[model samples]
Target: MQVLHLSTSDISGGAAIAAYRLHQGLQHLGVTSQMLVGKKSSDDKTVFAPKSNFSKALGILKPTLDCLPLRFYPGCDITRLSLSLEWLPDRLAPKVAQLTPDILNLHWVCGGFLRIETLAKLNQPIVWTLHDMWAFTGGCHYNQDCDRYTSSCGNCPLLQSGNNWDLSHWVWQRKAKAWQNINLTLVTPSHWLAKCANSSSLFQDRRVEVIPNGLDTEQYKPMDKRLARELLNLPQDKQLILFGAIGATSDSRKGFHQLQLALKHLSQSGWQENTDVVVFGSSKPENSIDLGFRTHYLGYFHDDIALALVYSAANVMIVPSTQEAFGQTASESLACGTPVVCFDSTGLKDIVEHERNGYRAKCFSAEDLANGIAWVLQDGERWQHLSRRAREKVEQEFTLELQSYRYSKLYEEILHFGDREGIKSSN
Candidate 1:
């Protein structure tokens, strides 16, 4: 079966990475897959982007223009402004019509790539893989603690709106009208996200399914710790703790503050001098904050192999995000045979088993996070066992082949049952 995937970028953000991996996996399984992206970074022949200079220029300007409506809400917090308006017109529907595939899989089509009204224009079977709450909410991506999206969104915390008919409500209405009858199916990578989709006012009536994101095992497998440390120039004497993501230090949702608290708590228990922190995705700022232990800021990783080496060298990985659609870094760390320590909440609950492959600390508890870290490193033999189980967990459950097979099956079911009544719940 021929399938086409739509995304903002082919290999940039976490959502695009997940989408690209699935596209590659389907091709590996002999299913013809093609990706149409706003930005194509790799030289992959299967991925296509706008060719004309004008189109390329528009792609660069779309993300800024798509968010132009937010200028009215001057009081809205700028740091939390992840809203996308999708008001700009694009001649993408004609391009999609020309390529005409049996299935259209949408992944992170915002960031000025696709419009809310554009889905109905395609007139094809759609499988939307949601990477965040943007697919359901009025404008904001992560709702934070606000439950306004469960009903009609207004007085959005992200926008700092205080009224019911603000920008958020207007955006929500647009989505409701344009996408009311579109033939679309929803797939979430985590059960937590599936629950959110089912409870949301926008997608409550739509079909929802759960499918975990997959990675290449061979590219992310364990490497010798000493050799990895030697190549990376990290000290082999100190026990290393890993933490990082996009905006690893500045983004509040990633819980860097919570990590700071946990590290301080861990230091009090006689680990201040023995443990060191290794961070990627963020460089050390001019003003560095002390974590009681020495911190090494390795900055961003260029590829999966570089990331795998960091994971393989570390004793444990820490992911303290307040909420995540799916913890991609957590899964990547596990694939490298490293135990992970994360709060027991959100999508991360699916990846880390409690005290099995890794430790799931009490949700948002810094003390528990610190204790979990100590427990994982206290005994060398136990750490080895956890490391073995970590790789095993990824191999048995989150491999690329498994994700490809599941997606192919879902595609067959959607095509065979044109009406698609029985394919309601998850596989």
Candidate 2:
């Protein structure tokens, strides 16, 4: 069967990469999967984007125009978190109609790539994957501690608007109206996000399913630590702790500041001198961050091979995220036989089996994080056991082949049900 996936970019962020991997996985299972992205970065023929220069230039300008509505909310703290407005001039409905896929899989289609009204325009059955809380919320990507989304959102905390009829309310109303008639199903990458979506006013009446992200296991498997270190030119003597992502330290949600506090705690507890920190996706700033130990900043690794090398080189991967939809790096580290250390909260709690595969520290506790790190590294025999289980966790539950098969089944079910009942008509 033919499947079409829509995303903002082909392989830019974690969400984009996840979507692209699923497209590849579907192809491996002999399914015709195509990705139509706003900004195409790869040379994959199956992945299509606007070919004309005019449309490509408009693509570059869409994100800026989409945020123009936020200017009305003058009190907003722009750096607090990300916000998306349902404003864009797009002809994507016709584009999708021309492609004529049996099923439409939507990924991170925000960033001005899709207008809010676009969902209702699609003809085929839709499977929308939530990479963040944007799908259910008023405007902000992560509601954080806000529960206003369960009802109609107004006076948004992120927008800093005090009035009940604020920009967020307008956006929420638009979604509530436009999406009421669509043939859509929601898929979340974690149970925590699934719970959040189920509670949201927009999705409360809709069906929401939990499906964890999957990766290529063979490409991320373990390599010799000594060989990995040598390949990356890292020192062999020091035990390594790795942390990375786009804007790894700068992004507030990533919990880099919390990691700094944990590292300082480790230093005072007598483990500073023996350990070094390795970071990817970000380089050392002009004013370097002091994490109580020497830091090695190996910037972005474009391909999977280099990422695998970095994961293999580390003894432990610390994903100290305050909030995460799903921790991709943690699973990738586990696939490489490197234990992960994350808080026992959000989506991360699902990936690490405490003390069996990895350590799940107390939520938002720097001291507990340090304690967990020491626990993982202090016992050499236990480290091997953790490493073995880490690999096994991904193989049994998160392999690419398994993910493709599950998605295939879901697609079949949607098709069968749509025919028996009524499906949304073509635009």
Candidate 3:
């Protein structure tokens, strides 16, 4: 069966990475899969982009143009939240038709890559994998404690607008109207996100499936810790703690502030002298406040080998996010045989077992986060057991082959249902 995966980019962000990995996984399993992205960073021939320079330029500017309607909400917070009304140019449907795939798989297409009207025009069956809350909500990706999306989104907390007729309501109305009759199936990478989708006003009636993101365990597997540290020039005697995300410091949802607090607690409890912190995905900010430990900012390593090395060099990996769709970093750390410490909340709970392979601190509790970190490092014998289990868990459950097989079954089922329906119609 031919499958076309649509994404905003091929390898730029976490969502793109997950989508690309799935595309690769499908190909590995002998499925014909091609990816169509707004921005193509890889040289993969199957990954297509707009050929014309003007269309490419428009693709880059689409997200900014789509947000122009937000100007109507005078009280809105100008944060990095998404407010996709999906009223942009509908150029993708024709391109999709030209490709003529049996199924269309959409992933993170909210950066003005596809329009709401275009979704209704697609002839093929659609499988939309939601990387965040954007697909169901009125378009603040995380929703951040806002339950308005569970019903009809209005008076959006992210928009800081209290009017029922605000921009969020307009977006919600557009989605409700345009997407009502589309042949679509929903997929979420985490059970937490699936639950959220099931409760959402838009997709509550749709079929929602839970599938965790897959990774290449061979690439992410553990390295010799001493050799990794030696290659990176890290001090041999110091204990290293790792923390990062796409926009580690700036993104409030990543809970870097909580990590800082946790590190401070660790410092007071005699970790100050020996422990050092390593951050990826961002450079050290200009005049940044001290994180209460020696800090190393190794800005964004795109190479998987380099990332695996960094993960290997650390004693433990901490992902103190407020919420995550799948917690890719936690999975990667585990695959690298490094114990992960995250809160017992959201998608993270799926990856981290309390005191099993890693530590799951109390939700939103910095003290508990610090305690978990300390607990992981307190005993070398326990750390070895945790590390061993962490790698084994990924090999058993999160490998690309396992993910591909599950998806293959899902795709077969969807196509079989469509074929049966066609037969019924012919009669």
Candidate 2: residue 241 lDDT (0-100): 91
Give the per-residue lDDT digits (tens) of candidate 1, residues 101-148: 898999998878888889889877899999998989888778888888
lDDT of 1 at 154: 83
Ranking by TM-score: 1, 2, 3
lDDT of 3: 0.87
- Model 2, 33-94: lDDT tens digits are 99999999999999999999999999888877888888887887665458888578688999
Compare candidates 2 and 3 on lDDT and give the better one: 2
Model 3 lDDT-worst window of ten: 418-427
- Measured over all alpha carbons after superposition, the RMSD of each candidate to the real structure, in angstroms, is 1.4, 3.1, 3.3
Q: How accurate is candidate 1 locally (lDDT)?
A: 0.88
Residue 422: error of model 1 in Å? 9.2
TM-score of each: 0.97, 0.97, 0.96
Native-to-model Cα distance after best TM-score fit, residue 210 in candidate 2, in Å: 1.3
Order of all candidates by lDDT, from best down to worst?
A: 1, 2, 3
